[model samples]
Target: MTGAAAAIAALVDRRLTVAVAESLTGGLLVAELIGVPGASAAVLGGVVAYNTELKATVLGVDAYLLAEHGPVHPEVARQMADRVRSVLAVGGVPADIGLSTTGVAGPDPQGGQQPGVVFIGIAFGSTVTALRLDLSGDRQAIRTGVVSESLARLNEMLNEMLTGA
Candidate 1:
């Protein structure tokens, strides 16, 4: 199975729900997850916070952090993941997992970062982790890579949980 499909299956099997927050990858991360069959059972929703201001106003990213490190920082990714669960809550019940992507993917730099510099943040249970990826590709390729990497990271985490690792 594809990584995205595997992650979706794991989530469903574990009765876990996920919300996504996106920046450099736009909405592609959520799109990839929800594209899998039966994803509705685990994917609550997603936010495309491409704008720095929207990261705070919509996803509740800290304004001071954005002012200091911009939207491409690892902390931004972590905050996006940590907060999206609540932001996309249903009936006051937050999702079990939050996934976020924040980075620069382009021929030009963004927030002083070169293209293909990415962070994928994942929040599950009480732990929040940011995985940094220094990729090498054009804009579209970089974005695609981020989605793939995010799913792989989720799959790894799910396996760890399942095996009690």
Candidate 2:
């Protein structure tokens, strides 16, 4: 099993639900999570906000915030996670953790942000944090790297939660 699947399985075993909001990686993060057996138990759902409008409209991201900070900013990632959590909670999935990835994964950079520059946000309860990763690769490779690293970070956070370390 992939590391993401395994980490998700661990979360499920602990009865923790997870939701993802993806931008550059699209639905690839959800695909990796649901690729595992019994992912339905832990994975609440996901939002693929490929467009800025949808990110603001459907995910409830603030337009002023997006316009002020742009989509690739860390605050955008944090808002994405918070919005996903709120959505999942209303849906009764009630996710305990939310993960979001936003970035430019492309042959040419957009939004004045460099390609392979990713912001991954993690939210647990009222606490939200973002990690920035500057990866080196082609489009697909960068996306793959983001997915892998996001899962690793999730695992680390899970370990911290479980071990209180």
Candidate 3:
């Protein structure tokens, strides 16, 4: 099994469900989680809001924030995480954890942010934390690295939470 699979299994064992809101990495993060066995128990759902409009309309991102910070900002990532958690609640999933990704992964930059710049947001219950990563790679490599690194960070967070570290 992959590291992502192991993480999902651990989350399931803790009876914690997870949800995702993705943009720059697309739905690759969700795809990775769902590829694991017994993911249905731990992964509640996910949203692929590739467009800024959908980030506002579907994920309930604030219009002003999107306009102010653009779609690739840390605030956008945080809102994406919160929105996905709320959406999952409506679906009766009520996930215990929410993960989100927003970034610029391209041959060109957007919103003045360079390619390989990413913000990962993690929400547990009502609290949310955002981490910025300046990565180096091509588009595909950057996306893959973001997905893997995000999961690894989640694992670290879980360990910290479990051990009260």
Candidate 4:
């Protein structure tokens, strides 16, 4: 199954919801979920932290970390995922999952990292993990891959967390 369909089904079946924080993929990751029907039953909301400052200011990525390692680092992705889960919460109601996308997708590299070097972060229950993806493509393709990989990571998490498979 597609990651969007799998995520929505698993999330809905388990009475859970998800939020996102994005950088390189922009809003594409969340947009994929929203495109699937009944996504509202599982998707809470998302944030696009496209700028370096916004990574810290908007999504709560540590300012020191951004300065020390820049926005494309795994820690940035992890923080984006871990913190966005709290940011989307309202009145003590928090989403059950968080996902993040951060990377370099460009004609020129950022933070000394090559193009298509991405880290997808996921925070589910008591666990938070980051997936490093070194891809080969133009800008759009890299971003597209990030979105697909992000959802697939979430799909894997759903399987492990819910289906034990």
Top candidate by lDDT: 1
Model 2 misplacement above 4 A: 90-93
- Give per-model TM-scores: 0.98, 0.95, 0.95, 0.96
Q: Write the per-residue lDDT of candidate 3 for residues 1-165, one digit (tens) a residue.
A: 576887897798788888899998888999999998789988988999999899999989999999988998888888888778878774565778889999989879998999999999999977888899998989999999899889998898888878999
Candidate 4: give the clashing pairs: none
Residue 49 lDDT (model 3): 93
Candidate 3 regions off by >4 Å?
Answer: 90-93
Q: What would the C-alpha RMSD of candidate 1 be, to one decimal place?
A: 0.7
Off by over 4 Å in 4: none
Tell me the lDDT of model 4 at 30. 92
Task: Supply candidate 3's per-residue lDDT for 79.
Answer: 85
Local accuracy of candidate 4 as per-residue lDDT tens digits, 65-108: 99999998988888899999999996778788889999999979
lDDT of 1 at 152: 93
Sum up the clashes in candidate 4: 0
Error of 3 at 131 (Å): 0.4
Best model per TM-score: 1
